[model samples]
Target: MAQEVFWRRKTLREMNREEWESLCDGCALCCLHKVEDEDTQEVFYTTVVCHLLDMNSCQCTEYERRCQLVPSCIRLEPEDVETFDWLPITCSYRLIHEGKDLPEWHPLLTGERSSVQQANASVLSVYEVRDNEISEDQLIDFILDED
Candidate 1:
């Protein structure tokens, strides 16, 4: 029998749990808080990270309890790809959803976790503060140009 190539092409839903988790580029942009202008419904990104996010790891400190602790936290699903506006432009899930190939910096592509950080895709050294510590007015200043 011929061996199946993993990355030939796979949709979000078609991926198994390990493959699904591997899709995260570890950019940590999704963990940041965002503001939306109700009138225009335009989402604006901020540097304020979720309280649960570990700045060093660029991942939630408490992943399983995120929804319980942060009621507003969004649980991304394959179906929500097109609808969720908060996802970063560089997110692997979003990229796959839009029919784009993963960037070269992605760990899956490079086979190295540090590759994302090296490419500046991971939030390493760039987060500002927990959402609870920052005021809405301060958000404007924390907006990062990293992307």
Candidate 2:
């Protein structure tokens, strides 16, 4: 008989720093600009990349100091994890929080950083404007991408 190793399910608060950080799948979907409908409170995602994001690596260029530079930047705190619905359905953090499985191409599953791009799950090529050059109104025009 094979021994079964039971993995403990971690809530956002229970995750250590390394586990929390590793939950990011490098898809860069959250890096895009979002437009929230004032009346309905529905959020619409745009293809405009944040100025702090590195397009090639799909990682933040100034992650540690992002809040200092962009005063409006929202930090992903443990308490707010479940409330962040604007995070994409494909997001690892959101998946893990919802008790869902990571996709096949996720780096943690495949051990390949480029799998996200190859699987068309990353915003690697399809994006525009760094946040500094774009205004809120212009985001509507960039709110594209079939999914």
RMSD list, candidates in order? 2.5, 2.5
Q: Kindly list the per-residue Cα lDDT of model 1 for residues 1-147, writing each as its tens digit.
A: 776545445778788878887788778878877777789987877778887877776778888988999887888887766774467888888777777788888888788888888887765556767877977688777776644
Q: Candidate 2: where is the Cα deviation over 4 Å?
A: 1-8, 145-147
Model 1 bad stretches (over 4 Å)? 1-8, 144-147
Q: After superposition, how far is residue 90 of candidate 1 from its true place, in Å?
A: 0.2
Best-fitting candidate, scored by lDDT: 2
TM-score to true structure, per model: 0.84, 0.85
For each candidate in the order shown, give its overall lDDT on alpha carbons.
0.76, 0.78
Tell me the tens digit of each residue's lDDT in model 2 across 1-147: 765211136677888888777777889888777778899998877778788888778888898898898776777877887786878778877776787778889887788989999998987666767777877778888875655
lDDT of 2: 0.78
- The top-ranked prediction according to TM-score is 2
TM-score of 2: 0.85
lDDT of 2 at 65: 95
